[model samples]
Target chain A: MPRPAKKPRKSYHHGDLRNALLTAAREVLEERGPSFLGLREISRRVGVSAPSAYHHFPSRDAIALGLAEQGAAELATCLAAAPANPSGSLLTYGEAYIAFVRANPALYRLMFGEGFPAVSQHSAAIRALRERSYDIMKAGLEQRLPASELPIAGLFLWALVHGLGLLLVDRQIVRDGDLEDIIRRVLTLAGTGLLHGRGRDDGQSGPPPPPPGTRSA
Target chain B: MPRPAKKPRKSYHHGDLRNALLTAAREVLEERGPSFLGLREISRRVGVSAPSAYHHFPSRDAIALGLAEQGAAELATCLAAAPANPSGSLLTYGEAYIAFVRANPALYRLMFGEGFPAVSQHSAAIRALRERSYDIMKAGLEQRLPASELPIAGLFLWALVHGLGLLLVDRQIVRDGDLEDIIRRVLTLAGTGLLHGRGRDDGQSGPPPPPPGTRSA
Candidate 1:
């Protein structure tokens, strides 16, 4: 049979321990990378005996995944609550993404790490949450661009925001640099098509183009 | 006065301790975040006595800075070597950013981390490297956009590549997604107009009303 539940072995009070472990894991992550972090390290910080800590987390990976799940849910919430209009979403998405990364660096790293939750199967809630952010972009792309250009526009917008988020979080790009200004300007540029006076492109006017690389990695 | 230089207490062959520290620091970075990393930990891993490391690196921050410098230099090289064409630079820049992050994530983190090399005050070399990438987009923008619009174009292109890099490195977006196609399509959309082909925006036609937060962010 699959391993029995680890929590509530001695008593039903697993909630406190769960939060404590997550707190400790965040500490470890701040101090170091996710790889060097061990459950025992967390247990030590939590003031609990090592094996006893297992009551909350069956294994180290489980704890990490738990954190990642929480992050994805949170990120989804962040993007979901963005301003109502696509234009507004365009302006605030970068700010929200950057703020999320700054507030929860470790959790953010976990959410987007090598073990990033897979889209094909693994978790339905996460996939939906992640896709919702994409949906915002999709709506924008659908409304703003042609159907044929969906794939590239989607990825492009995603990449621009994603990279800027990382830069903001890691402090490579400083907050004092006026990021909001930078992001809005970029979006406007992306949205405008170099030719602004003549607006409303329906795709037939420009040259036909193929999709991006087959293998992105 | 600044602390006196530590003696070259070890072998006089001038065998580089700097590079050794970098490798060890890389290991530490992969294992943790910035604040908690220590020279002691790295020196221990390098099999060098802790104090000896001070001869080369005055402190762990110095080590972190070195890593950041190295990463930026490498990134500059990659961008510099890329062909001048917007499409080529787009593809090359995308691959370069992803490759740097994937191959040396620790260094990549250091490259953008807090208290490290501040990007806004970039060294002349780093500044030019950044500007060169921006220039590619500027050139594209110049064809149809006003010089005033270059800054916005720069940020957009940078954002797209930066976001793609992080997503690919973190595996949040997709390791093998269609990145090249994404770049071209993104460029095409931004270059010609919105992907929607809804308007002609070439700056020369007229400076129609600029979008409100366009310059602010």
Candidate 2:
């Protein structure tokens, strides 16, 4: 009543096969999209038989986890370069974070979008890579929020930046030359939730409303 | 050098064909996923020929736009039911928004996820429906923010709630019972950027941290 699953053929200990497949998978994700990915296509690109490809990734989802790990590691590098000042560094980190997604939208979607494997499905290496990225954000938020508010604060800020990045990438809102300007205003508002006082020092706020015509994106 | 694109056969008006196809497409989106959608399969389910299906939907993307319209309309209904108080209403809207996404994840992804057509590509009907949903949020924010800050404030709040909904659906962060408690706290913080005064006055703030063994999700 059902077809049998395909199995890898000609198995051998080629230590680089996994890495090779991962490289090929990332390329596929970048060029086409998540939907266009296939183990057969990856095998063809890598000059290997489909069965050999299956040695490392039993299904398309397995290869997706590999690509997601690569994406997480790259994001970690971006956040790692954030400035040492927690408040100031978060703005920088937010810029870098949003830029990273804009630059590699397809890969970012693979890592964070639906259809990616769940936590229980992630391998140890993948899990650690993902956590490392979140930890960087958590470390920064710990400085600004009370211990009791850390979790909610983390979710709030992460959602704000992440949502902005997605909106920009989706082209729902167009930002001309003022992406960083918008980011600064947004993260500032997110940090202090006020248009005056502490947030005012960031240069994104003022007591005077725009004199009728001026507008910020 | 290339095969010709397939054309819809025998164009004839079916009074309710468009509506019927959309209903069927939604069912497919709910059962399988975006990737599994195909006009031919939809036609088979609807007892129509492939050419007949094409008369209603020229391409897969055309059908996707139809589905996205349905999703946006549903979202508008949820937001429209918000309570009258701007601040309090936003929290209720956030809970409803997140719950909607969680309940219809596949449809939500179809509407907002990548591979869906861009806004410029949307028809007049589709664009209006999408904007109608956003207008509700903008109107709610108008009550609390200065007119000059409305656009930025709206974007900030949208991204925050959107991000939270995505994260919760993605299961990146686990919130146990009483999702509304978390939603109220997060929105209050976003509105005031403080754990005291504005955010604290809502009964969500305290000088003392959680008892030693307690933890927030």
Candidate 3:
């Protein structure tokens, strides 16, 4: 998926160098993965001087944050397009989420990976984008569950989808045969486990005691 | 909590130098966080020369792999000890998982964080440790779930707890009052959702179309 560098043109017209830089940086990130991203390299691709690039992005982290902001927005769009029926919406949302991650593995990694700060620590704009994405899921959940359940339920749903997405990206599991079918079955297992407490009747078996001579670290 | 470095002893004793270096490395990782781990510093703490240190861990990635392996073993131990009653075992395992993360945030991060290779790419030992940890959860899930449902069911459970643990680590969610009680409630939501499809009946409201003028990347 190599993207050829755009031909450099005269600087006679300075049209949104900031956006041009972001687009170029994102292309580099997706093509080379997060580790290869360099502000100078990205600037060079966009035919901008280092000083001009610095004016918009002060550091590598700033550029990462910009990419993450874009990623979150894209994620929100994907989530928003999920089917709205309460019965199928969660599954649709889950499917859409996995699809997005599959399409943009590196960008998805940057959004949640150690390369960026945690959600709580992200810059204001990035944080808002993340929250907005979560809100789409929450609003979908709101139609079926009690208001009291929304917060933790939202967290659980987010974790389920996020974890599966990571596992897929790591190649821990493959989306075999039909992609949506796999998502549907996995989501059904999780969603049902949450709704009915399916294992409630199974007898309890306490974990075996630690082997003798074991010492806590 | 600070672990004072052992008094560097005479070079006359080379007893268990490998284990000694690993122990020191773990102490450093837990104390200063993963970012502070350096082979020379660890070897120095253990009264070893730089070349001696290199003998055990050729590079920092090797040391990280070692730490991750240790963390996986520790996590496996925690998972193995949960009360085994089929009815409550999943919840108990979930609680233990979160508690382990809360107790050793940095080590937990090291085990699951960006430092190590992907699961598919990990060396044999690291991958084995990871699978061993997951198998403990699967064993618990087995007692209650049909054999047909075990695989995906186990994944959902792992994702649920892992996601919650990460959210707690990131400070995206807080554990208020009794810790286990909160975990119990969150698990109930996800597990029950899977069992009953509680959100099944809500009307289908199609997700709104993407906002105008937005272009896909």
Candidate 3 achieves a global lDDT of 0.69
Give the per-residue lDDT of model 2 (tens digit) for A1-217.
2111123434344447777777777778778777677888987787677888776777778788777777777778777765546435555666667877777777777776655544225667866786777667767755543344556666676788788887776667754747656766676566555221234223533333322321111
Mark the regions of model 2 whose C-alpha exceeds 4 Å error after superposition. A1-15, A48-52, A115-125, A194-217, B1-15, B47-51, B115-124, B194-217
Candidate 1 per-residue lDDT, tens place, B1-217, comes to 2211133445443366677677667667767644346778887776677888788876666777666666666666555554445433344444444555566655554555333433223556555555554554344334434445555555565666666665555445553656554544455455454222323344354454343323323
Report how far residue B25 has shifted in candidate 2, in Å: 2.1
The better-scoring model by TM-score among 1 and 2 is 2
Model 3 agreement with the true structure over A1-217: per-residue lDDT tens digits: 2233356665544567778888888899888776577778888888767677777777767878888888888999888887787787777788888899989988887776654443226777777777888899888778876776676677778888887777776666642556566667778766665455423443433453332222245
Q: What are the per-residue Cα lDDT tens digits for candidate 2 across B56-159?
A: 67777788888887788888888888675754656666666777888887787777676554422566776677678777877876666567666667777778
* Top candidate by DockQ: 3
Off by over 4 Å in 1: A1-15, A23-51, A59-62, A83-106, A113-129, A143-146, A172-181, A193-217, B1-14, B20-51, B59-61, B86-106, B113-145, B173-179, B193-217
Could you tell me the interface RMSD of model 2? Answer: 10.2
- Let me know the DockQ for model 1: 0.25
DockQ by candidate, in order: 0.25, 0.23, 0.28
- Please write out the lDDT profile of model 3 over residues B159-210, one tens digit for every residue: 7787777767666664365655556677766656544442343344342323
In model 2, which residue pairs have backbone atoms overlapping below 3 Å? A192-B193
Candidate scoring better on lDDT of 1 and 3: 3
Which CAPRI category fits model 1? acceptable
Q: Interface RMSD value for candidate 1, one decimal? A: 7.4
